[model samples]
Each structure stands twice: as structure tokens, then as C-alpha cells.
Target: MTTESIDTAAEIEAIHAVVAAVQKAQRAEDADAFLALFHPDAIWTTGGGKFLNGRDEISEFTRAVLPGATKDGYATYEPFFVRFIRPDVAAVKVRQQYFNHADELQSQGSPLYGMTKEDGRWLLTFCQNTPVVDH
Candidate 1:
């Protein structure tokens, strides 16, 4: 998409909103809210390296794991980089962090979300969460 055809600033803002929503859902351990952010055929790879295809698969995995995930603390996502391949497609790089109840960082994740605009709403179409380990 050309610059004249789309507003880059608005798109970026919308993308950030999605990321913020994900963070909120995670903090609340709201699996349904989190799943609603993905496309029907979305793909996801967890930080532990489990590959899930489609919303059904994601839902299954999420339901199994999301509960009590935030009993101690929660994961947070920040969309620091966004590359628009087109007006409707973007690659977002997020900084994911897991903190303990005392706010100490326990683990970090580098998650890349492949987002697509479907019906004017941006949805996570493909994503991979890789744990960050200190060398």
C-alpha cells in the first residue's frame, strides 16, 4: 500500500493498541480475550516451543495454560518495532517480560507477531515467542 492510500501513524497506533490489549489480557488471565485477538487461522509458537495452528489449537493450548499463569505475576508485551509490508500486513517485534509478585524479572521473551488487517481490524495472524536466555 502506498502512503497516499493509508495513514501510517494511525495504523501504528492501532497496532500498539492491540499489543496493549494483549498485555492486559495476560495480566488478567483472560484466555478468551487473548484468543479473540488472533485470526481464525492464526499460528502461534509458545516460548517453550510448542507450535499451534489455527484458533482451535491456540484456544486449546491457552485454556490449558492461561489459567493461574498470573497467579504470581504476569507477562507484559510492548510493541517496540513495527514494519508494514503493506497497509494490511505488519511484522511487530515485542519485548515480553515476566515478573514475579515483587516485580522482579524472572524471564523474558522476544515475540514477533505477524499481524494482518481483516475487516479493518488488525489481528494476530502468526506469532512466535522465544525465550531470552543470558549467555
Candidate 2:
């Protein structure tokens, strides 16, 4: 692999890890853990269309809404695509699956995460969650 390819591989892996962390945090309903993945100036939009500007806003919304969210169901996030808009910036599309305690599929989400590598760490800079309606 060329130098560029090698760097790309490592970046992709790092981005995937961030997505996995999101899943883990959400599954456990740990707001602090989930908020830690975002940049201090990050912007986020929930699947329901609420816009959260900045990490502080996101943190407030998350803390108020996330704690009991998974009481009935847990979600998993899997990166389906990672596109490098720049060496330090990545646009990641993730497939989110929610399953109930009974192990039945509950809902699905298509979340796009814009991550920027700062200080050698990938942080969620911009994100939008769109719920998928299964007909």
C-alpha cells in the first residue's frame, strides 16, 4: 500500500471506532460517554428534527433525553461508508439498528457523522440522524 493508502486505512479504522463508541454509549445510555465523542463546537440533529448547536446544547439535549431512551430497546451503529473529504475530515454513514429487550427489531436509523481528526483523535463535528420507516 502506498503512503496515502496506508494513512487512509488507519483513518478509516479510527473513524469506525468512533462510531462504535457511539453505539456503546447509546446502548448503555451514558450521556457523558456519548457527549465525549463530539467536538466542543459540534452540531447535531436528532432523528426527530431537533437541531442542537454546539456541544453544550447537544449535551443538554442528550442528558435530558438519552438516559431512559434504551430502557425498552438498545441500538447498534455500524459504519457503512466512510468518505474522506479531507485528510483530517471524514463523512461517515452509519446503519443504526434498534432492537427491543425481546431481541426483536424495533427501528432503524441512517445517521451521517462528520468527524474531524483533531490532536490525533477523531471527534464528531457534525451529525444528523434520520429514522428509517419500515413499511
Candidate 3:
């Protein structure tokens, strides 16, 4: 493979790692771990339409919700597509699914995560979680 291909592959892997970290953190209810994957100025919008600006606001919101989020079911975040807007920036499309202990689907969401590479690490800069509603 060419050097460019190699670099692209590595970058994709790194991005996937960040996505996996999100799932891991949420599943484990590790707020610190979840927050660490975001940039200090990150913004997050919930599926319910609440907007959280910056890491502090995101932290507060996550702390309040995440702890109990998995009490009934655990969520899995799977990145199905990633588009690179720049070498250091990517738009990731993730499928979020929550399953109960019985392995039944409880809820589903589509989240768009805008990730940026800062200090050689991929961090989520912006994220919007939208619930999959059936009409």
C-alpha cells in the first residue's frame, strides 16, 4: 500500500477507536472516560433536543443522565460511515441501539459525531443524537 493509503487506514482505525471508547464508557457508566473523549469546547445535542455547549455543560448533562441511562438497558454505538472533511476532521455517522438484559432492542438512534484531531488524538467536537421515530 502507498503511504497515503497507510495513513488513511491508520486514521480510520483511530477514529473507530474513539467511537468504541464512547460505547465502552457509556456501557460502563464511566462519566470521566466518556468526557475524556471529547474536546474541551465540544457541543452535544440530545435526541430530545436539548443543547449542551462546551465540555462543562456536556459533563453536567452526561453526569445527570448517563448514570441511569443503562440501568434498564445498555447502548451500543456503531460507526457505519465516516467522511473526512480534512486530514484532521471527520464526520462520523453512528447507529446507536439500546438493548435490554434480555437482548431485546429497546431504542434506536442515529447520531452524527464531528470529530477533530487535537494534539494527535481524535476527540468529539460536536455530536447530535436523533431518535429514530416511526411515523
TM-score of each: 0.96, 0.93, 0.93
| Local distance difference test scores for all models | 0.94, 0.90, 0.91
Among these predicted structures, which one has the highest lDDT? 1
- Across residues 54-125, which tens digit of lDDT does each residue of candidate 1 receive? 999999999999998888887889999999988899999999999998999998999999999999999999
lDDT, residue 7, candidate 1 = 92
Native-referenced Cα lDDT, model 2: 0.90
The candidate scoring highest on TM-score is: 1
Q: Give the poorly placed runs of model 1, Cα more than 4 Å off.
A: 1-4
Model 1: clashing residue pairs? Answer: none
Q: Could you tell me the lDDT of residue 58 within candidate 3?
A: 94
What are the clash counts of all predictions, listed in order?
Answer: 0, 0, 0
Q: Output the better candidate (2/3) by lDDT.
A: 3
Model 2 alpha-carbon miss at residue 19, Å: 0.8
Better of 1 and 3 by TM-score: 1
The TM-score obtained by model 1 is: 0.96
Q: Candidate 2 at residue 102, lDDT?
A: 94
RMSD of each: 1.1, 2.4, 2.7
Per-residue alpha-carbon lDDT of model 3 for 1-135, expressed as tens digits?
A: 123433877898999999999999999999999999999999999999999999999999999988877778898989999888888888999999989989999889999999999999999999999999878
